[model samples]
Target: MSKDAPPHISGTPESSAKARARKLRMPPLRRRRLEFDDVNVVDKAMMKKAVGGTVVGNTMEWFDVGVYGYLAVTMGAVFLSDADKDAQLLFSLGVFAATFIARPLGGVVFGRLGDRIGRQKTLAITLIMMAASTFIIGLLPSYDTIGIWAPILLVLMKLLQGFSTGGEYAGATTFVSEYASDKRRGFLASILDLGSYMGFALGAAVVSVMQLLLSESDMVGWGWRIPFLIAGPLGAFAIYFRLKIEESPAFQATLDAQEASAKAGDETESLGTMGIFRAYWRPIVLAMVLVAAVNSVGYALTSYMPSYLTDSKGYDPVHGTLLTIPVLVVMALCIPLAGKLSDRIGRRPVLWIGAGSTIVLAVPAFMLIGQGPVATTLLGLLLLAVPVTFYVGNLAATLPSLFQTSSRYGAMGISYNVATAVFGGTAPLIMQGLIALTDNDMSPAYWLMFTSVAGAIAVIFMKESAQRPMPGSMPSVDTEAEAYELVAGQDENPNLDVDSLPFDTLGSQQGTQSDADPAPAGTADHR
Candidate 1:
């Protein structure tokens, strides 16, 4: 298969027909078609429920976290002293960063555990953790009530939630994608992402409503805890749905294979973190780079902006939240569009466009933050959402495509969480620190630009995994020659190569550079 022509459609009619006829000779697992035209063999029935199940589970998890962000002002009182607003915010940001730190560790522990045991059990555990922590947070006493211990307790609780999320998303996304029919993977993945965003959106709407109903004094005093408490119910409800769901067929098949080995039930064979760490470190690094901007810009542009408007721009928090509704709406609208676009063209070009636009627009976005009219801010939101959609949509589908079936859950979880923690998780704090240090929003712009550049660098190095057959690890390459060789390696057809393919004949660059393969001393485009 060439890079340009869809791998799903690559083989000649005669070859495809002969191959279909020869299906009887293949193993049951191998007999299933992995391309768009094939039926979804894994979880054919339960897989029908995978996307909805993932969304419900993710919605519950993000709802818990999003409530804190939406109620930042209220939660600040519980964690920081009134003596210093910026200091309090900084402290709260640290608390926020603590969760990211925990996320990767959780991913490692959970990924290894899930691989050792099953995705079903790990997801069940994560949902329970999320629900318990959220409920515990609602019942927590504030600083005035318990002094320093109250804040310390809050930090500990955040660690639990962070750990749960680290495992949950990667597990859920991998499960859903692995089980889902390839034809609709992007669409289904995008729908799952809605839960992540909607959780925040719902939190925003809830806080917005509370602000309208409650006096500012009341909200600051005790009203803020209401939103955090709400997450408990949502989490508990989601757990019921999550538990009812079955295990993914792919993971089950792997388990069956591993069990067939002489070392059956030997946990180490199933659960070695070192094996994963040493083998697929590139994807982990690439994931961190890829999601940092995705998560950070998510924090800086949307989450941090509300507080920014209230404090620096002198806008009413209520008015600012209301005005920013369009950004969310635009994001929701664009997310699915971007996902569909990637399905048609490719994930790499979409990701490249996302990185490139972020490079060019990072400064302008912040500069426009306080500029001319409400209309200008609206324009900025449109610009931000559209390019950002490209990244988010691609990420929704692309990251999972990088891993092999054997370790997809664990690899996806750890890499995604660690990247998010450093870049996304710490974004608000780091950007705010720069602003405080420099006395300008411009500093945050530079901070955002730094992360965006990392994402672009990541995109430059990433091989196009879209339209490629799954159950295979992403091949090593940044250019056409390596891509050609990679295709030749996996191709069922013995005679296929770059020069003879329709895609190459069509003169498509196919997102692969024209450079030849590197020598032993040369650089490889790892994460």
Candidate 2:
């Protein structure tokens, strides 16, 4: 045989075929070049308005949640006056869990609507529904007045609130994330949760004051209605802000691209519920796991802690509710700091800190709470807050990054609410049940530890998205100069992976460039 001739492989037919296959394989797709014009220049003023609007709505939603949570015992007594104390407490918590039952359905309906209509409009609708339902709950007739119908009406209103709330957080996060510049996304998005816990703290404070001032009969007879009634004005205020805001720029861009694609006769696949599931089930599942972990700790602190303190730890209703107020306020204040830290280091590292801290602090936090002094209880709550700060702070930024701009709202609605329904909303009841079943007060801690372990594992699989462009969108920067700088340093910027970006989805731009295209002047192709 001539020297140039191919030599025969000394292996079975399968090995020979495999060798041939390797030789014939296509080369990897080349990284796309980014031009200065390709970078999106964020409107700072508009971004701030968008963030404010979204945050206010989030705050209102959580305020309603906080009112319900802090008033769990009182609500039970008012609605189930015939039941034993334990039964009434259980009944109230059961009603609270019922709110989450409607979340998944709300998530699907509003999520798709947000994706279809616009984030701003859908958000306004959800806020109206949430506020109205909460206000109506305040006007609901008590068991004494209406007999069985009172609890039924109460549950119906809570379910309505749950339905609206299903859309609130997911839409808020998506709205802020899309509006924010990539560099400041973490810190900006974190502000939503800052509003969230602050709302919770406000609710606790209001309830605590009412408890101090009102007689027990007064609270049960009339005072409990005040907080829920307050939702009417707050919801109106949030709705006004939401209505004033425009659709998110990223989502608008996606819509524009879709329109352009249709005009040019390009086929664009619609990502409905099943389509989203089929296309992005992996990330959806991963996000659910992460949601489950963080919310377990979050709900345990915010929702369950008051009950745990009052019922199990032997604190009065007033002290139990008041004890968490300071801790929540402090933790809420620190959430943005953790978000900023995630921006500097990376999402995964900060998430690792959150997960690891939950594992380490869960048992100790419960132990300190069990000690029964104000200082020890505060310290325990603070320990629980540590992991919550790291975890919840970054979620608004991290979860949205998992999916593309086109389906992010829908995907988030499904993933977040489902996990919340199962783990988050049920956390209070579950902990209560766990303690009863095991006859061990530490059962809640063990549950938290288990969830954190799962969270840690999920973190390993999550893509590091800090300081990176969201999928299906252009690189977003705060200013024209920043856009130019990003393009100039594209090759050297580790976080900006041009190859991974879905440039094909950028509509008309897809046909304008190819692998052979050279980098724009002043930019180097180092990949």
Candidate 3:
């Protein structure tokens, strides 16, 4: 039979007539049609639940981190000794940076679990641990009450938060990405970061309110603890949402495939860090660079802004915190829009907009910020926020697209965490040190410029991934071309069940003619 021929009409003429009669008795297929449609083959309602579950954990983690950044000076006073104010602030931020130190470790541990077991379970564990740690920080005694142990406890709690978050941010992004259709992945995945920004914005709002309402002494004595304490309740709420959501069907399909292989006594393949690293080194390097650039700017904008305004621009800490609110709100709004735009135009274009715009505007924006008027500062900050939003908004969909399902969680977590630890987590401390050394108020701009350039270079190298189908199994080294070819090869083999399709289809270089092949029974789209 020709390849284009209709599927074999196997029934004999008499059986066909009987089947026609049965069809007339059955309900029409059109009656079951649903209005929602997207690339991922999931319904709209399920996708929303997935996004909600993923976003809550992200919000809680970032919220705690933002609270710490907003109250760094107060934390310094409470945790550090009766030393120089600058020294105390430095010590406090140093401890803040300590969290990044634990992230890479968390990435390895949690990423492994996510890849090996499942994304949902790993996220649940990390969220609980991170929230618990943040709550503990609020309960610790100050240096005046507990001596050096207070600072030591603070350091420990921060480290725990960092470690837990190591798994969280990346894991949440991966979870949402897997659930989203390729066409809508950018918009859906962007919600993960929107949750994060919202978390940070809410944290900043709380701190700003406290600073505005309370006396200086009251803020110093007790107001600093409120935000940290709030993490507990927020965490409980996040956990509830996470539990209500279902596992990634993509991951579950992988498991089903593995079980079938075992039952048939066929050898089932497993992915490891070394194997994944060897296959995906190019994307890994590019992802690290991309993440580093975006994160440096992100931390600079959110975590470092309050300190930068108060210390360098001579604004009140409360006013500095207040300024961040508008910036984060702009980011939160921009994230989903950027995601949808990327879906329309493509991920690479959005990334280019982010990197190129940041490179052009970073220096000028910082100059305006240093000018110190509310109007100029807001304008400068808004200029910077625009590019960063484009970058971050598209990141979840873009980054996870680089790897196959088997290796995606681990690859994303490790590379992203490494870059974040090196750049994003340290932006504020670096900015503080640079200003002190050079007395150049524009030092932060220089760092932003450097990272933005790196991001641009990475963007220039990234493969366009809009509407690209995810690999059903582990893809080969050339993920952009190989994944589609793999799917095509699977279509040519009639005996290979959908779950039995090899994760990596070697030696096939055919065009995507096989894309027309229908998915095997009980299988969803896999990439």
lDDT of each: 0.68, 0.88, 0.79
lDDT of 3 at 393: 91
Q: Model 2, residue 95: displacement in angstroms?
A: 0.7
Q: How would the candidate models be sorted by lDDT, starting from the highest?
A: 2, 3, 1
Candidate 3 C-alpha lDDT tens digits along 43-140: 45767798988888888889999999999888898887577789888998898899999998899889889988899999999999999999999999
User: What is the alpha-carbon lDDT of model 1 when measured against the actual structure?
Assistant: 0.68
Cα lDDT tens digits for candidate 2, 377-448? 999999999999999989999998887777778988999999999999999999999999999999999999
> Where is model 1 more than 4 Å wrong at Cα?
1-45, 263-268, 473-527
Clashing pairs in 3: 40-181, 470-527, 471-527, 473-503
| RMSD (Å) of each candidate, 1 decimal | 12.1, 7.4, 11.3
| Candidate 1 positional error at 324, Å | 3.3
Question: Which candidate, 2 or 3, has the higher lDDT?
Answer: 2
Q: How accurate is candidate 2 locally (lDDT)?
A: 0.88
